[model samples]
Target: MTIVDTALHDSLRVLKLSGMLHTLDARLVQAQAGELGHLEFLQVLCHDEITRRETMSMQRRLRRARFEQTTTLEEFDFHASPKLPAAQIR
Candidate 1:
């Protein structure tokens, strides 16, 4: 069944709460099934919004960084730079 009507969806979009909007249908189902209380439902929604914002912020920062390629220190070829200070690099 559809729990979120158009008005509610538009309201959520206007408030920029995409995470809550995305999960609202499933959460509503859970609430109707008696698996969540009012307080718990609100808490979960707030948590989802916070998580979404954090993830978006991180992605924005990474995109701004504009790294040529993705790599990690662990993937470095220590054997090729044996003469270098591998211990210090690690």
Candidate 2:
């Protein structure tokens, strides 16, 4: 009975070691993946200002087109088409 108990304990120890090694490897891989993803996020941030500026410029053009001399209702068809939005009513 004592021998059987000792064998069972040894098997459990081996299993524990295997599980720990697997978990450690997984953690290291995850850390590497996280670092790569962080780099991508930084690249996105670097271009964000440019993206914002272009968007604002486009918006300004749209705003200008909206308020640029349209006294007639047919000419001022804002929100009715993708080409024009936020135009004056009549």
Candidate 3:
């Protein structure tokens, strides 16, 4: 990384943009390879930060919910219990 890149990363860290900082290297590579414009680069960085925050929030909510097991209906075998009311479950 160049001096400018190091300085920018330090500034991002100080500003508590952890999400952007974490993805900085990969995003930089993508920007260079894709020849992304300034606004496009900024958009990607902002999106990464937003996605990180949202994912973290959802994880926190899930932990608070304290589910015994993480399961989805798609993994369920409804046919195994023929008596189960599939329509009511839905």
TM-scores for all candidates: the values are 0.72, 0.30, 0.73
- Residue-wise lDDT of candidate 1 within 1-90, one digit each (tens)? 335577788889999999999998898889989999999999998999999999999889889999887667888788887897878988
**Residue-wise lDDT of candidate 2 within 18-89, one digit each (tens)?**
332323334435546885365554454335445655777888987888875635566555666656545442
Q: Is candidate 2 or candidate 3 better by lDDT?
A: 3
Residue 58 lDDT (model 2)? 83
Q: Going through the candidates in order, what is the number of backbone clashes in each?
A: 0, 0, 0
Clashing pairs in 3: none
Clashes of 3: 0
Which candidate's TM-score is highest? 3
- The local lDDT score (0 to 100) that residue 73 gets in candidate 2 is 62
Candidate 3 regions with alpha-carbon error over 4 angstroms: 76-90
List ranges where model 1 is wrong by over 4 Å: 1-4, 72-90
Q: Candidate 3, which ten residues in sequence have the lowest lDDT sum?
A: 69-78
> What lDDT is obtained when candidate 2 is compared to the true structure?
0.53
Candidate with the larger TM-score of 1 and 3? 3
Q: Between the candidate structures 2 and 3, which one is better when assessed by TM-score?
A: 3
